[model samples]
Target: MNALMLLVQKLSCDVEEHVFSEVSLAIEKPESYFEKFKERLDERGIDSPIDQLAWISLVDALLDHDLAFELDWKESGLYICDVVDELLDRKKMAYISWGDFEDEEFDELPTSQCLNEISGKLKEVGISLAYLDIDSDSYVLITVPSSDIDDIKKMAQEAGYSIQDSF
Candidate 1:
């Protein structure tokens, strides 16, 4: 119900017939995620206009489940990809999410390997892991969820990464 969601919904509708509306309505049926998201945003005191828009983009992506990777990529076991080409601004780090996995899977090495691959790509663009959150039956905010920054950096460096921007 936020302005950015409205804009995205309107844009999606304009370009793709009824696709956006149907998706939006479906997502709204279970309102817990949206409600918690609003609370998280409020707690962060995110008053900036750009941050607001980013939040909207995040929500829209979540609603659509439009982030499934190709068979080739999924088989490679990675869960994210560079979306820099799709970014409106070069300075902003853009990434496309892959399909969701259960929260328990996140703590495993294979999962981190997948995430690390994506993080490796992002680091090439001077971006590090900002954070990742999951909102399904349980709403959670995972800030620096990884066990060690050194480990992440080592993995990234092994993947031919550059200096990541300070978050």
Candidate 2:
């Protein structure tokens, strides 16, 4: 078996306790809906990173089944608030896998980045990857095959996020 499987099997032997030293980490840009959306933005010269990130995340929130929105953007904007240009930093929140990028990809054509850096990293470390759903302003992590919901919940909670079951 590969190193990751071996590690999992070994660590799982105890079922109670084991000490690990360190972790190693390792994304493919998929031809997903969000990718196509990015292309559309490129074609139209939507060059602003903030705009790109926003539209990309919005498209992710809309098109990707892995990312379902509990509260529609329009409803929140029209009834509660207004759309504005706000950016967090070099990192932007994205709902689709493609929307998330590795630090290395920042220099490349924004249209070309991995599907989901987080999932890729998790899978590399023998951890199951969970899909994220947008619950209004926050995100909910839904477990996939081989995933630990509790583990995923812990990570999200640490990041100041909460979980929801509904789509």
Candidate 3:
């Protein structure tokens, strides 16, 4: 069983994008992570609809918040699966999805089908969908050159998806 599966069992729900972001943020900046995440949610105007219970559950899973905060993720064994270099020969990447944008959800189609469509569109625009991980239903992670970010964003927008920087 992978870490994701363990987390899913712990949370008792499907792991969503926000869950991953919050966990990543918490691991990266334990002391101020929650505050920063709340600020970010406010900036995106998503704070209002936040599920407080879910947030609490996530925090509870941290186990002894104060003590946990003092430890580094690597020391604490918080495994973050990073496959960018393995899949795309890149050190940096971003996650793309139909993230709450007022666009048609790709839920009707299988993830592979949607990815194929997105890949075809990207290829048509001379962009390579080189690195991709669609393991989660809510998003796809891909490696994009910094120079090509704008181009990829535009292409994703045209394809009814939104792009977000990976945490």
Task: Compute each candidate's TM-score over C-alphas.
Answer: 0.25, 0.22, 0.25
lDDT of 2 by residue, 1-167 (tens): 33322332322222212211111111122233335456544643554343124323332432233222222322221111111001101112222322233234332422112213334533553433332433334332322323454544454355344333222
Off by over 4 Å in 2: 1-133, 137-143, 165-167
Q: Residues 86-126, candidate 3, lDDT per residue (tens digit)? A: 22323222343323222344434444444455554444434
Q: Which residue ranges in model 3 land beyond 4 Å of their true spot?
A: 1-28, 38-109, 130-135, 141-167
Candidate 2 RMSD to the real structure:
18.9
**Candidate ordering by lDDT (highest first):** 3, 1, 2
Judged by lDDT, which candidate is best? 3
Which residue pairs in candidate 2 have backbone atoms (N, alpha carbon, C) closer than 3 angstroms, thus clashing? 97-115, 98-115
What C-alpha lDDT do the candidate models reach, one value each? 0.35, 0.30, 0.36
Q: Name every residue pair that clashes in candidate 1.
A: none
Model 1 Cα shift for residue 35 (angstroms) = 13
Point out the higher-scoring one by lDDT: 1 or 2: 1
Q: Compute the lDDT for candidate 2.
A: 0.30
Per-residue error (Å), model 1, residue 41:
18
Provide the lowest-lDDT 10-residue window in model 3.
Answer: 71-80
